[model samples]
Target: MDANDFVEIDGSYLEGGGQALRNALSLSCILGKPVRVVKIRANRPNPGLSHQHLHGLDLLRDITNADVVGNVLLSTKVEFTPRTILDNTYRVDTRTAASITLIYQMALPVLLFAGRSSRLIVSGGTNVAFAPPVEYMQQVLLPNLKRFGAGFELKVQQYGFYPRGKGTCQLDVQPVAKLNAGQFMDFGRINLVSGVGFCAGRLPVNIAIDMQQTAQREIHRLWPEQECTIETVKHSPEKTRDNGAGILMTANTTGGVVLGASALGKKRIDGHVLGSEASCQLAEYMRKEICVDDYMQDQLIIYMALAVGRSRMRTGRLTKHTRTAIHVAEQMTGVKFDVTVEPGGQTLVTCEGLGQLNKLI
Candidate 1:
């Protein structure tokens, strides 16, 4: 399928929410494919684009000079056709404090595909609900992507939490001619694993201290020899409306595989629970004996499609989000996908017809 062939997606098909829509839109922009989305998150309370979604859409429109028509509202369907993206530093501001990570997710793929390097400065919520915190991006995703020859730098100028969203981050991206595939089948030996707790806003300093102490003790119990650290940041009264905390754990493998897990603060949240949950999540990934996480599985599909060679990954589960991503990818590149479900609930995803698909796209 070339850029001329229009594709249609039932946005409410699976997971039945904005994520489906976001994935569809992002693929359209990255591949310069035109897409028509129907049943647009039909089950959602406010089914269409929220301010964050619209902001992401607007940023794409500005970057690719795409032709978009339809209501940029909650649950509304949209048709987008990306022309060619421009290469330069772009600035985007999400008026409402939406998750900046969502914006980064949508735009990063397109920027990577751009003919020239690009830089971006975005202002808005950096730490928000239902999204990866800034720490996750800096510590986990970006570093892992570097293994595949992806290189980018992110600088957080401020911490933005919920309600009162005022934060800033700058990104520098250097596009690569082609990506190198890597493997992570075994976690090797556990070198070090630790947890960090960060708190902001009206949060009491004692809360951060208590959470850190609790998390550190749990980490010590799990790996007695591992080292840990905790930190807290207090926000000026004028900068925040509420309290927030984030817990992150990083595990180093003997063979150099670095895996990260994280949990965020919520009302009545227990620090021990947060630490244990993050630790367990990392352990589960290691147990799966796979190289990629569920999130990376979905994120890397597009890169695999664009790569010059075959790429494969073994993941814990094929979530609806993963399925949606694969569907969108096939539509964009017309590359037939081979997905096998293992007996123990793991999934093997592979793409072999890359050379031919690259010609088509």
Candidate 2:
């Protein structure tokens, strides 16, 4: 293919982070467009592609039989040319505490149009800093995606933590001809706030229970009438266990709105503080009456561009990450996204979707 056929993207766009690379490549795969990204992660202390980023790129290349250049550590520029989306069992092992959910997010959109069912196995961090935990995917993202007719199953075989990462997860994706546009604007009553406090590093189980108690107390304080419950999950008491601890709290509204907030344990941060902060964050989002959480706003941008008909939804704020996704999608697929702040401060995003059908299906 000629160089003119490629969608040239500046990796140092607004966010200037890994997200720009992920969104650009995902849209390129589905649209059958080659992409050339430059100056990747230019704003971070460690500029250029990290191991985590490279793994995602490699997986995408393999899944689509794409030719990739600069699939290496600390590379600043890369080009990807996808041939076709294929179905197979793919695996990736980061061998570090790299964020696995980030990798999964990068590859999932492209898989939605696979010719047949596919299974992806990834090993790395399940819960880590600067990335959404696996629970968020399970409780929040999957539910919202289901509403759009993009259904999949994720089974976490082992939960890995930072420094000693070894978590494993299986993601099953089935082909869909088209995605139904999203219309998530209703803000109904909340039914319950539930959570799972996890204990890692063979820490005492009470460490998790304490966080649960603190989270519940904070939740009641923020939403006096809201019901709350929590449970604890942990690994066996082995010295070789992955080292980490955290709590993932979620809320479900009568309208089926799912929001998640989480905090990982640290040496300086107390468990009470972690739980309290997570609870407060979730409660704050609930009070806003927004259909989707802040992070989901960015995540939904790609699907909105690809879904049939017009897609509109109310989200917390228009994060720079969301804006980056929107820019990349428009550039890659020639889709338009409308973003405006609502009267009550929430942002309403709308898009005239490409309505691109899955050729495989």
Candidate whose TM-score is highest: 2
Q: Model 2 compared with the native: what TM-score?
A: 0.97
Model 2 C-alpha lDDT per residue in residues 1-361, reported as the tens digit of each score:
7889889999899999998999999888899889999999998999999989999999999989999988899999999999999889999999998999999998898899998999999999888888999888988899999878997899888888877678888999888899999888887989889998878765777778888999999888877777899888666744237667888898898887888888888655467787887888888898898888877888889899999999989888788899899998999889899888978999889998999899997
Alpha-carbon lDDT of model 2: 0.88
What lDDT does model 1 reach? 0.72
Q: lDDT, candidate 2, residue 337?
A: 92
Predicted model with the maximum lDDT: 2
**Clashing pairs for predicted structure model 2, backbone only:** none
